[model samples]
Structures are given as C-alpha cells and as structure tokens.
Target: MRCCLARRRAANSPQKTQVSLPEMKEQLSQLIQQALDALAADGRLPEATQPTIVIERTRDASHGDLASNVALTLAKAAGYKPRDLAGMICDALPASPLVSRTEVAGPGFINFFLSGDSSRAVVQRVLTEGEQFGRSNAGAGRRVQVEFVSANPTGPLHVGHGRGAAVGDSICRLLSATGWSVASEFYYNDAGAQISNLALSVQARCRGLGPDDAQWPEDGYRGDYIADVATAYLAGEKIDATDRHVAGKADPDDLDAIRDFAVAYLRREQDLDLKAFAVHFDRYFLESSLYESGEVEATVARLVANGHTYEQDGALWLRTTAFGDDKDRVMRKREGGYTYFLPDVAYHFNKWQRGFERVINEQGADHHSTVTRVRAGLQALQADIPQGWPDYVLHQMVTVMRDGSEVKLSKRAGSYVTLRDLIDEVGCDATRYFLVARAPSSQLTFDIDLALSQSNDNPVYYIQYAHARACSVRAKLAEQGWDWEQARGIAALPRLEEEQEKALIKRLDQYPEVVAGAALASEPHTVANYLRELAAEFHSYYNAHKLLVDDGELRDARIALSEAVRQVVANGLWLLGVNAPEAM
Candidate 1:
C-alpha cells in the first residue's frame, strides 16, 4: 500500500501548462475529431465515415499523458498505412495551449503530452472545490435503486451479509456522488418456509426444549440467539421492527404469533447491527407485501395470458427456457404456494412501476442462479422491461480468521459469524474497510488480528493515521504562532514544484477520475484502493519533507498539500461508511 506518486521532471524541464485533466481529455478528443474531419474533407477518408474518439491514459508515463488508437482503427477503412494515417492526423491537429507536444508511437498510437501546469492545477482545484472536488453530474439525475443485504428476517446478519451491506451502501454513496438520485433498499422475505422454521425453533425454545430435545422440529434453527428470542417471548417483550411493532405471546403452541414475533425481533436486531455499521436503507420492501397486494397473482395471470406459461402436472410453469434458462420453471406448485422465483419477479416489477428504471441488487454469490430465472420471469410479462432489467452485484463469501484458524461459528448465530460479533470485536470502521477493500467477485478473508492491529498492516489504521498526522501538522502550525493563511497558501502553490510536492498533487488530481470510474463500474473497491494509495503518497511526502520550514511560502504550500490529502482521505472513507478519525 506504500504508493509513491510518479517522479517529477527535473527543474530544467519545460514549464507545464495549467489545464484540468477532464478539460485536457476533452481537448485531445476534439483535436483528433478535427483531424479526422480534415482528412475526410480532403477525400483521404470517406466523407460519411466517423469513428468514436477514444482517449485513454497511458500506462507508462514515458509514453505520454493520454493516447488514442484512432489512426490504427481507421487506417484500413481510410485506405492508408496506419503510420501514414497517424502522420496525417498529427499534421492536421490543432494547436492548443493544453498540448505541449504530440507523438505517434508503435502501430500508429497517437500520444499527447500535456504541460506541467495541467497536473499542478489539480491542487488549486482541490482547494477551491473542497469536499465537492470529486463529485460530478454524470448520472444526470436518473433514479437508481440499490437493494442489498436483503437477508431474511430469520437470524442476525452474518459476515456474508456484512460484505453485501458495506458494498451496497458504498455503491449508493458512489451513485449519489456521481449525480444519481439513489435509493437504498432492503428486501425482507418475511413470509416463507424459513420463517416457519424460525417460528418452530423459537417455540421449541419457549417450551424449554433445546436443539437436542426430542420435541424440537427436525429443521428448526439451533442458534443460541434463538434461545434469547424465546426467553424474551416468554417474558412478553415488545419488539419494534423497521415497519411494525409486535409483542410476543408466552403461548408456545401459537405458531402464528411466534412467527410474527420472531420476524419482528430478528428484524429489530438487524436494524441495530446496520445502525452500528452506519448503513441506512431508504426502504424496507417485504416479500409478504407482494403476495398481499395481489401483485403475485397478477404476474402469474399476465405470464399465462402472454403465452409464456402453461400448466404441467397441476403446476403452473413458465417457459424460462425460451429466455435462455436450462428448463421451464414452476411458478406455483400443485400444493398452492408460489415458488420463490415468482415473488422475486413480482418485487422487481413493483420496483419498475415505482419509477426505478435502473435497479441493482447486491447479494451473495450463492444467489447467482436466481439472476436468470428472475430476469426471465420479468421478460415473460411483456412489460417492456429490458432483458437485463435489474443489475446484480454478487460478492463472494467472507471468512473470519482468529488465533490461526477460521472462526466458523458465532455463539449467537450458531452456524456463521454474525456481523455484530465482528463489529463488537474489531469495531465498525475496520470491519467495513476489510469487507469492502476487495473486489466483490473475489472471496475475502477478514483477519481479525490484522484488522485490530494499530500498525501499518491495518489499512484502516494506516489511512486514518495519515489524516491524523495532517491534522497534527496544522495544530503544530498554530502552536508555533504561525496561522495558515488561505490566500498565502493559494498564491504560493506554484512554489510547490518539488518532486514530492508534485507527486502528491498528481495523486490529488486523480481523485475525480477515480470516483467516476468506480461509480461507472459499480465497484467501490476502486475508491478504497485509491484512498490507500493517496494515504501512502501523503505519508511518503510527509517523511521526505519538513512541513514547518523557515521559508513561510514553502511552509504554507506544504500545509495546503497536506490539507488536500486529508480532505480526499475523509471523502473516500465517508463513501466506504467508515469514519475518518481525526485522532486515530
């Protein structure tokens, strides 16, 4: 995680210009478009032909700031050698202040060299924009609903659910930052066979029967938390869930009452866990509501009317195979209950009706099979919903390690490590950071020892420590009777031409691009990785240069750079649902 900013040019190098990165990319694209237009005008290329102007950042700085393969892409179509076409395009390129030079490298790739001032301007931009530096209107105010951690209200949230929550909440934050009117939702499967099993489990515990007791249901949950619920129920406890409140009855034989109380009680527990992790949902959608509102039945009738469904062996079947599923799926069994897939389709249809044209469901990898089935069901409705109507982000399971072994079970959850156990042991900040610092498709190992460590090994501590160090520098400045003058710091930015200073500024400049990329890819781990690198850059800069120098201008400039680093780290951490402790 110790990332050093790219090395700066020698002092005698050519002076750099002051263009923003986004503006520079735009200018480069426009210049290439103009070049292509000139070629077409001269009959060198077809008048009706146009290609996308794609500009990408060079992986190696020696190549240039940005590069394009337009010359190579258009060579065959334009009837010229790639190199010859590149030369023609370069010749027609418009002169602009943003471009210091342009070069054609390897197989006709055009590279643009920007002035030093272009990268240096990011410092001033960061200062001017403050917390709004990396935000953009890319989403165009579109509405997007992100549903995550839709764990059934049967038990406390486990580590897998924690991963989903961290990722889902971060996605909402990322979408909001990029101009999407985002809504976070949690779908609860409150009425189902699992719920029935939960009720039986709690009822068995209420009757003084443990998992080993003969009277316990064969498939009942054996989590110790079940016992706690049973004790509370026997004492007539009132539990307030997200949507309702229910007081448990002491009647062990009343399965209906037990089911209701168990769902409400577990939901309340989940609410507390999410609150502790700083995750908030805008909506709590219930599966039972779909059935109660007649949406499920209506969905079935629509599928039948659309010729996508038929009856087989007294069960209604949807022709999911027509939509690429391996076989037809049962919408409802002969016994009268709808299968899980039907309810999912109803939920998504309801989401579409509610005006969420874009929806993302963040769930565990175990639910991968449901993706095709649900989308196929939606397609059968002929509702004009896109083939891939609702998007999915599936995260692999998380394994918690402790004392040189995997901590497989939580005493309360029985079969898995509960999220509350993690929060209680390693704290919310570390837990969230650990869960979200990797790609969702990759399995994660949540090492408790590493997370709890205060040393550099813990990324959360390392990043937070960098922020604290920056704050300490400001405090030191005041203690020495040298107040930070905003005007002076802004004016002396150009004097911050040292290699370390330029490197830090370059890292700061990358924040906007990082945010936009992460948002577009629906990967918040990109931001997490970026923050870690930014922290490393700050720490390296701090160690190499003294902030409290005798030169007033240099001191103010360094302090300004440190402050920008602090701002970015705080902003990125906020996106991850982690607190940026000022005194970590």
Candidate 2:
C-alpha cells in the first residue's frame, strides 16, 4: 500500500501558483519518460522505447494518488518481467516535487503518491480559477457543427425531442468548453411527406373537417395543436418563424397557401417550445432549400457519375452496400420524387462543403437505419468524406412517469407528451437535468414526482442545494461579523485534515479531466454524474463540519473549501446547461 505524509507550509503565508490535474499528469509523464531515457542510456532498455504514457487517478486511496501501467506495457518490449521492469523504472525515475514517492504494485503498475500539500492545493486552484476551473483547450478551437432536435414541423415537440435538445445543447456547451468552435444547426425536415400531411391536416381543419370526418386526408395529423394552427390561420395571423414569415391566406380552398401557412405556423410553435425549454440553434437549414438550390439533384447526378448508382424497376438506387450498408437504397422514386435519405445526403454534403470538417447529428434512435444509408450515400458521391463522415448521437426513447404510471398523452399534442408540458410542470432546470442526466444511448425514465421533490432524491435539487449550502456559509460568516481571507484560507489549506476534506479536494481536482473526457466522448452525462457525486461529497462534508467556527485560520480554510465546492458545482451545472442556485 502507498502512503503520503503532509508537508507543512507556513500558515497565512503567500503561495505559488497551483497546477491543474492535466498539467500534473503531463509533468508525471515527462518524469516517466526521463526514467525511460535513463534506462535507454544505461543500455538496460532499447533506444527510443517510448510509449504513450497514460496516467490515471487511483480509485482507492490506498493505491496512491495517480498510477501508470507503463512498466507492464513496455515490459515485453524490453524483454523483462513486468515487476522487474517496474522496479527498474522506479529506480531510474528522477526527483520531482509533485510525487512524494513511487511504488511498484501488482502487475507492474507504477503508483505515485502525491504529497498532502499537492493533493490539497486543488482547493486553492478551484478558488483561483472560479467559473473557468473545469474548462480546457483540448479541442484547439476546431470547428464542429452539431445538428440536433430537427423535429419535423408537423406538430409540437414531444418528450423525445426534449431529450435531444437538452443532450445536444449540452454537447455544444461541452465542445465549446473544450475549446471547439461549436456551431449548433437544426435541420428542418420541412419539405417531405410529413409536411404534406401537415398541410392536408390543417386545410381539413380549416374546412371544418375533423379526423373523424370522411373527407379528412388518410395521413392527416390528429393533434389538437393542428386545430389550434387552423384557428390561427383562419384569423389571418401573420406568423414569423426562424426561417420565414407567412401571412395565413384565410382561404380554406387554397391548398398551396394552406401548406405554406401550416408549415410556418408549426415551425413557430416548435420555436416557442424550444425557446421555453431554453434551447437555441445557430441556424435553421430548411430541407426545401436543398431542393430549391438543386443540391439534391446535384448530389444524385454525382452519385450516377461516380457509377455508384443504378436504375431498376423505374427507380434510381445507390449501391449503398459498396460502403458497408446492408443493401442498396433508393435515391429517387419511380414518380421522380426523391426519398428522404437523398435530402439527408445533400444536407450533409452541404455541411462538408461549408468547411465543417466535423459534423455531429444528434437525433432519435429511430433514425438508426439512416446512419448506414446516409454514410453510404456520402461515400457513393466519391467525395473526400471519410467512411463515417458525419457522426451521430442517437438517443433512445424517454418515458415520463408521474404518480407511479407512464404519462403518455398530452392535451395539446393529443398523441404523446409534449416538451412544453414537462417544462411547464417541473420548470426548465429540472426538465433539462432529467433529460440529460443519463447516457444518450440508454433508455431514460423521467420521474416527474422525483424531479419536483425537495430532497436528495432529486438530483438537480440535490446538486443545487449543495451550492446553496456553500453560499449560505459566506452569508453566515457575514452574519457572525467574520470575513474570509482567501490567501489565509489557501495558506491554511494544510489545516484541512479530515478524510472528507481530503476526498472533496481530490474530487475537485478531477473536474478538468472529467470535462475533457466528457467532451471527447460526446457524453454530457459524464459531467452530470460527476456533479451528482461531487454534490454528495459536499453535502456529507458540510454535514460533518462547521465553517463558522471560532478559530480564524480553520474557519478561513473551511470557507475556502466550501467556496471551491460551490464554484465546481456551478461550473459542472453550467456545462450541462443547468443552473446552480446559490439558494434552493
């Protein structure tokens, strides 16, 4: 087992600047490389026996602060047993202030036990960095376009759309924090059979025909919101959506005018729904624009020119199997109208041409079939696009539960729960947190009762309350006629000797790594999970300790720790697009 002793620093004295976890990891990696170089120079190991060193925090405190498997990784390469190699590497390692000691454990794992001061310095670092604490420049400001919540403007957004908006927007925030220049785009499927059905439904409603009426279109939408749209249209309401403005014609007989009006009306409704949910898109690219600009046709011609397309049974098909699709897919139908996937291919091709080297599509898992077809279409174009050109984050279904049963129907939508319904019931913070608190690929169960709870059962509430508790400490200090000295608290950091204090500092140190990893993996849930865990740690520590103590040095140190906790909770919640309230 590895153990480290606290190195006492002058209480209430000025200290040097703090190093972040990534910087410390890099420094440790350099030290290991130095050891490798020494081994090479001593002729015990081959020259340039350098491997990419991976340093990870030890889950168990007994194992040490950080660990590496470099020895086990390079053991075979050096013709030495793993344990023997670890000992040799340890012997060769130079002195460093960051690591107090090194240990060769089972399977040749090299564990570095950090000095107590180094471990506790995270509190000072968190205080110094504040809101910018967890952010990093890992992306190097690369341009990344994230397309999400492109719900067809046929009806109001449903619960599934809520998940996509929350997850997708959080992803953009994550990428931006990691230094990526993120562009959030929403692709409007505004020119398809679905939109045609929406127009027919609205026109039928305008003609005083209901779903039960025999004159209703077979594929007409049955949502009560459709009736609302028709009412607004008959009123000649001038509706302005993000992309266009349409004055309702008030002509029940004009199908063309009704189509335009209905699309605009529903698009505006979707805009309101997303706005109420606190989601925004940088651009709304319309599917009709693709057809109007002839990109769809141009894409089809290119596929044919590349010989990746064929004509059979009076339809044009792309040999999607050439790019790993299960089979070929139809590009244009027998009646000359293109299929939905063709428009998708054109849209992505436009994305590539616009200089978006990285494009991520966040959509429902129901679009799984399109992933292969879309990629295959991109490949068949003979474009320089990679095999998996545009990436996709497909989220599974969301089931909203209330009072022990599934809440399936919404009065406005008349079919499924609307995103606005959830937002109105629980407010935006709880809704956003619940929607994104799980991995995208996992099925999520949103519990309305739990989200509204004031106890720890509510994750959003619990996390926010921790921040609130930390904030209350300062208020209490003020109430007691005591002021906190930040420099004194940092200098007195060595006074925080409790296991809980140590644990909280260690957790705070892991934030930047968590943010970078979550951004890279396109997993916002990782940050959500970390916030919950960190909140739990803070709550436990706060419960066991008192910040407004009589001892000035100890009080300052505890206040500093609490403030650090507050800063980190705020930072993590900000990344998830959720708020961390100073008071519950």
Candidate 3:
C-alpha cells in the first residue's frame, strides 16, 4: 500500500523548452498522402489512385516510433509487390528534423523514428501546459452548453443521477480545457404534476406529527428527506387554517397551494444536498421560466411554419416522422395539456437561442424514448435553431452495493439514496471517481466498501497518495535549498536511468495524449484510469530506488522528475474535481 503511494522525482532533470509547432500530426498525415501521390505522379502507378497512410504504434521498439501502411495500398495500383512500393515511397520522402530515420519493412509497412528532439520536446510541453496539455483547438472557441443531472425536484438525487453528474461535469471540464467555452446547466423539473403531489405530501405530513399509515399516498415520496423537507417547510411558518381537518372543506386555491409547496420544498432540499455532494451548477434552468418567457409558444409557432406540426383532434402534433422519428408526436394531448415532449423541444430551442454551437444533454437511462423526438423536432426546425443543434447522451444505471449485496434503493415515487447520503459515506472525491470509473453505457456496480476504504487498493486513494507523495518530496527539497521554479543548470536528467525511473518518465510524457483521447471520446473515465496507472508507475520507481541519494546531482534530478509528476497528478485530479492534498 505504501509503495503504491510513493512518488519518486528525478533531480538534475533535462532543461525545459516549449514546442509551438502547429498541427504536426496533420502535417505528417498530409505528407504520407503525398508519398502515395508520388507513386502515381511518377507514372510508376495506376491513374488517379490514392491510398491512405495508416500510421500507428509499433509492437517492436526496434521498428521505429510510428508505423504506416501507405505501401500496401499502392501495391495493387502500381502492379508491384508491397515491399517495392514501400521502397519507392520511402525514397521520395521529404527531409524533416522531426524524423531521424524512416525504414520500410514487413509487407510494405513504413516506420519512421521520431528525432530525439521531438520526444524531448514532449517533456517541455507537459511542463508548459501543466494539466492543460493535449487539449485541442478543434472547437475553435465555439460556445457549448451541457445540461445534466436534471432529476426532478421531487426527491434527492439517487445513485443513477451520480453517473450523469460525473460524466457531464468531466465533459464540460475537458471541453473548456480544449478551447471551447462551456456552461454547465441543470433543467429544473419544478413545474410538473409529480412536484405538485410533493407539496401535498408535505402539507399532509405537516398536519400530523409522525407517519400516518391511513392517509399516506402510495405514489408520494417516503424518503427520510421527505420528512426533513416537511420539517423545514413547517419551521417558523404558521399553519392556522385547516380546510382538510374541517368537515369536507377545500382550500380555494388548492392546486396553486400544491404547486407552491412542491417548488419551494424541492428547491431547498436539492440545494442543501447538491452543495453537500459538491454537484454544482452554473445555472438552474426552470421549465416554468421557459413557459413564462413565451419561448415554448415561439417554438410551437416556428414548428408550424416549418410544416413540422399540424392541428388534429383539437391538439397540436409535430410531424416528427418527416424528420426521421418513427411516428408523429403530440405537442399537446387531447386533454388540452402539453405532453412532456413539448417543453423538451422548447428547452433545446432555448439552448440554441443562447448561441451555443453544440448542446449536449446528459440524460438518464429512463429518457431513452424521449431523445428521438426532441432531436427530430430540432432537425424539423433547423431554420430556427442554429445548425448542428444538439447531441443527446443516454447513460446507463448505477447500482450501489455494500459487502457484496445490492443496497436497497427503492425510488418509491420519491424515495431513495440522495447524493448527500453517498457523500456522507464515501466523500465527494470518492463519489465523483466512483461515478465515472465505468463506461457510461455499461451498468456500473459501485462498491461502497471499496470507495470509502482507506486502503491504497482503492484507485482514488492511490491517485491521491501519489499527489501527496509529490508534495512531500517537494517539501523536503524546500527544507534543503531547492525550488522547482529554478531552472536546472544541468543540460538534462542523467543517472535517473533505471527501468522504474524511465517508466515514470514515459507515463508523464503521455499525459497530453491521455487528455486528448479522453476529450475526443467524451469519456472522463479515461482520465481516472490514467491517474491510477501513472500513480503505479511512480510508486514502483520510488520503492525500488532511493531518491534522497548521497549524490547531489542525482538527487536534484530525481526531485525534478517528481516535480513534473506532482504537477501532472495535481492537474489530472483537479480536472476530475478530486483534491491533490499535500498531506494525507
């Protein structure tokens, strides 16, 4: 366990420098295409033929840095064997300082060995960008919005909602790091029938002291927080007039009473819990607010103009099928009330109105049926909504377990484990990490025992330990007369050359790649897995060698290596909303 947490640094490390080259990979890809074009241009190949370069990692280190297969593609058209085509392409390659050597081997595969300068430059890039390395300008400063964990205000967030929170939050963080301006949103379900019932539930509970088995609505909330919310609502507020207790009486504004009760009750409770769980939002978009703003009316009218909606049976229906939905969907039911889908489309239109180039809705598992029509409606009204409107992400369920048994989690209308409950048990860092530790599409089983455990066996603890170890190493260095800010007088890291040291260095070099891959995939779990792997590498290095050595140069070099490690671990954990503590 101790070994898993140790973070060994290298002193007398290489001098850091920045690499500002623009689109090196893209340029390399284009050059490979040129090589294929050369085969055709030289009349040594067939007419107008183009075979793509397939560059990727090599299994054998001796093969080179990156391998490509442009030759195999040119073989058929050139009427020559693959190896012969590879030879021609290699001979015609342009000179580059980035590539020290290029060799053709194994069925016409072209392997290029990157110059040591490029590899060394990667270290500097890590130092310069800190945690923001590998972030892309692909977004080109596009404004984006992410709406997530909008679980109705009727109850506390359950286990499943935790997954959406982590996924959505991490996606927002990744996008912002990559040059996209991002806003995190929560769509409040504060104006629905279910919420109305919640107000009445509290009203009923307020009239009584304890659980009333006789009058308790079966479909209403039964969570402990329900009682808690009820208490908060009753505190210091007078309830003198009682129509229900009288002989068959009614409050004139009964529906309004219920609506008012639900909204306030949920807002207070959710606020308390959201803060406790550290699931924050920049804005809480209310469905009622959209309705009040006439955005819904505007959306419906625009849909009609687009010929996507028609009146039938005194109810408005959107021709979603025309936009690829299986069937036309009702905007308002025959009962003269809007279907759930109506406001949903209106919400997305509002997202577009806010000038977002892309909108991502991180929805729960249950909303599978609703995603299609909302997208279809947007496509139907593309003239009104900006192009490339929105993308929907449906995450699967999360199961909470303890001691190998499924914890009882019955959302009985509004009864279940709140986000706060999980936080109280495992803490915010553990909760966030556990939420994103699995694939979003795969049903996740969160082991309460594992997350809350102090043992390094827990991946979160292991990562945190690496961060803490880095800080400790730095503190000791500070006790001596060294600071990471001072440039290394030595040309480069020397004598930190054991396998373990190199292993840790390699891990540090790959941070940008890991971050870039995670953002592209829209999978934050990749970051979590990366931190764990990196921690293991650093730990192994620390345990095998003594960084605080008798030799000053080697000691300084080791500390420099550890300083780089600390920066990365701290940055990665910060992106995930996990702390990198100086001391455990």
TM-score, per-candidate, Cα-based: 0.92, 0.93, 0.85
Candidate 2 lDDT, 302-324, residue by residue in tens: 99999998899999999999899
In candidate 2, the residue pairs with backbone N, CA or C atoms under 3 Å apart (3 or more residues apart, or in different chains) clash, namely none
Give every collision pair in model 1. Answer: 16-116, 16-117, 17-117, 17-118
Poorest 10 consecutive residues of model 2 by lDDT? 1-10
Worst 10 residues of 3 by lDDT: 240-249
lDDT of 3 at 132: 67
TM-score computed on alpha carbons, candidate 1? 0.92
- How many backbone overlaps does candidate 3 show? 15
Per-candidate local distance difference test: 0.88, 0.89, 0.72
RMSD of 1: 5.1
Q: Over the stretch 1-584, how does candidate 3's per-residue lDDT look in tens digits? A: 34212212222223322433334555567777776677668877676765555677565566876778877876786788999888888887887766888999888899887665455454445565666666767677899899998877777667777788888988888878777888899887666777767766766666663344778765666665566555555453332211111111123235455445446556655666666666678887888887899987888888888777888998899998887689899998888878878888888877777888788888877888787788888888765554335777778977788999988665432445557678878998999998887778888888999998999679998998988887887787778776554244122354456656655655676677777777767888888888998899888888877776656657766776776787888888877878788989
lDDT of 1 by residue, 322-439 (tens): 9989989998999989999999999999999999989999999999999999999989898999999899999998898998799998898889999999999999999999999999
Query: How many clashes show up per model?
Result: 4, 0, 15
Native-to-model Cα distance after best TM-score fit, residue 266 in candidate 2, in Å? 1.3
